[model samples]
Target: MDRRLPVSPATPLIDRFGRQITYLRLSVTDRCDLRCVYCMKARPEFLPKADLLTLEELTLVCDAFISRGVTKIRLTGGEPLVRKDVITVIETLGTRIGPAGLDELCLTTNATQLPKYADRIAAAGIRRVNISLDTLEPDVYRRLTRGGDVNVALTGIAAAKRAGLKVKINAVAMAGVNETHLPGLIAWAHGEGHDVSLIEVMPVGEIGADRSAQFLSLENVRAALARQWSLTDLPDNTGGPARYARIAETGGRLGFISPLTGNFCDTCNRVRVTCTGELYTCLGKSGRIDLRQPLREGGRDALDDALDAAMASKPLGHDFDVSPGAAASVDRDMARTGG
Candidate 1:
């Protein structure tokens, strides 16, 4: 029996499929320091500074969702920590959102700049963080991230942990690429006192990313971990959709987010707000309600009406099929989508 709350017409965010939207992914900036092959095109064109939502505008947009029962907000971007005044933004939103029963205020980052901001983030009321790193080996890391310093991310992770924030690691497990190193990645994260999540490479856009070539199944990853130690499921964490498990022998935890192979759309309860203020009901599909224009026009009623339209048209499930000839592609890449 499903234990989820029943979808209600009175609910401001319940979609047509009876799923109540409670989570929001807010992208602070589309600018990133590193260019990973899977997430960006070579020499990617980033969003200009003027295109981003001001802190005031973002707060107004968030208030609309909070009033409607949205409880979780995760700041994501090409790299959230890179944005100027991010700590100030987090401080503002975190202080305001929590009193209204918002469960979490978190940020996702590549962690290159986290060493500088981790302490400030903790002071700003962000108690949790998600770090994006694909490998532990410095050389492979540099190769995959296109000249990124693995040591810098490691230092940042240490900083995050020392700041008393809970850290979780996200790794994109691409076959024939990082597949063989999954165990090592998990072990490293566990050693660092963090639960590591292996994400299947999503088919978002074509930046020379061959989904069929890089896609790896979570079931296979689960089996491989089983060979090393006892693996058992743990309760799901808020802010992200990864299903976690306990590594019995080592006393570590592992998580798997297989969006392509394991569709969790039936219980999907999240929406995304892009850097440019486009509200996306589904990450893998394209149906956006522009909040930038109305938001800039500055009227409470206009914002409310836009939010209602988005809620009404919220998708039940994405039309993303990994099967050949039936697959769908998102109009924007992961950077633009707040992934």
Candidate 2:
């Protein structure tokens, strides 16, 4: 292991491979309101409240990361909105970390719970909102999310836009499930003044165990869209390897996150932390630092050293591309992981 760590606290915390770690995806809670089949099992075993990180502890962790060059922080979860006091958690982190050089605070949600809190979340200092809506058709949406109401999600999206929050829709395109709805999904989001990105169904978690049939390549979907519309490549700086293109006719835009097809690992610049506190260096590969233990026993300096040591071993890429879509067979449930 390299004994040297980044000397400049203002610079990004660089790993052994020289990737600057600027983004931190923190999962505040593991409980969700809806059961997305592709994400987790229908009835997931929720973590005990005592085991999850508290708001103050999360703030401390964020402060530590910000000092080590984590500028962007995104709150994720099984469905973060389900957590009581979530708004306060968002506000606390945003308020405490902003002056310390935290550049952006964002969250990924199912939108099922957003209508009630979208305005407040925006006011809480969330710069952008990523809505996870796999399909636009109510029936298909219900089928995919197992009884989720698309109208409520649409209402939330409207509320988010009205609140002046930059909104993006993340759709996980599955074969025979949502592949046919790609064009419509993009059209609907675009019509609503939001850009939409289609992600290939990942083979992760127990839900991913038998998902070979569900995997749909974004490449194929892009090809189909190209047949109908003239697509223009657009520059994307969202800090992820997702490629963006403009739909020439509708003046809309679409992003494709081809993790399996292209393995964006070379450009990987983020890390994830489960609500229970395991810091995952890579979403698709193994090896994580026991952040909960360290955060509980070690305090700031100990946490810093632990993070530096673990990040040094961050993998170059994942093996998902080894089998394209089915190779990365992760047993950890997506709900439990800070996905």
Candidate 3:
């Protein structure tokens, strides 16, 4: 005999899909130091402080989500560390949940400022860090980032390592643009004791149309690597939703994120909060629920309602099959959209 009971639409916590919303990607600010060509065309005006979510308001929204089963929180942005008093934000959230209570509290930064803030970050109870480093050559770095200091970024990675934080390097693979140095970057990360994530060039922001020229899938990259090195699945290191494999001769690991050719949406468990407080269920979607208006009007109840709507609207998967021109027309610039 079965003893399971049916759930009602009035269920207080779970969403329509029965997937517990347990992760929140909070974008602290839309401002960034580097204007990476793929991320933005030019420097953008800083969003007015009044328009952005205040610390108190952000905490309230986070609390609402936490109450509904959100256990992991990540701080992101055009570059999260660029915001002032960011440490205060981290500390305030840390007080709500003990170090072990929250399943994970992580962050993603470009790493230009990480070297200086690494210690403060570790002290604030942040455990995981992902630094974006696409190229090893200084000239190539300048070309991609539109004149970013590659040396500074490298130094920041080293500082994070010294601070005892779990660090990962995110390399956005673009063919003819840093593809030749892919192996070298992986080997360097391995030697430095950091995890390397090779991601497919995803067409997500206002520049999605331009992706046709810059975007390259991970399939070609995997084939190239396989020919040069023997890969074996790593033991006991199952990265949720993504595969982690090891190279035979190297003491390093490689990660391939193939969203174009292969999709992992079935296991997707993340929700993004725009800097202006809009909640987006999927990264590829143009629609988002504006929480700012409701939050300013009704407080906690409003936040809960907004979160519920976002979870309910979570799509089954993203459609990159849409023409690049069409994709760009619908979405905001990547920096503004919190990619």
Query: Each model's C-alpha lDDT?
Result: 0.81, 0.81, 0.76
lDDT of 1 by residue, 157-179 (tens): 99999999999899998877887
TM-score, candidate 3, is 0.90
Q: Stretches of candidate 2 above 4 Å error?
A: 1-11, 96-100, 321-328
- Looking at model 2, residue 167 earns an lDDT score of 91
Can you write out model 2's per-residue Cα lDDT over 112-211, one digit (the tens) per residue?
A: 7777888888887887999999888889989888888899888888888888988999999888988888888888788888988888877677763457
Report the C-alpha lDDT of model 3 over 1-339, residue by residue, as the tens digit.
Answer: 111112122323454666656778889888899988778766556678888988766776666666666778888889988888777777767665664346767888999888779998888788789889998899999988888989999899888988999888889998679999899998888888888888877776664236766667788888888999888776533323446788876767788777777797776777888889988887777778999888888766666677677777888878775344445533566677675
Clashing pairs in 2: none
Please report, as a residue range, the 10-residue window in candidate 3 with the lowest summed lDDT. 1-10
Clashing pairs in 1: none
Rank ordering of all candidates by lDDT, starting from the highest: 2, 1, 3
Per-residue error (Å), model 2, residue 113? 1.6
| Poorest stretch of ten by lDDT in candidate 1 | 1-10
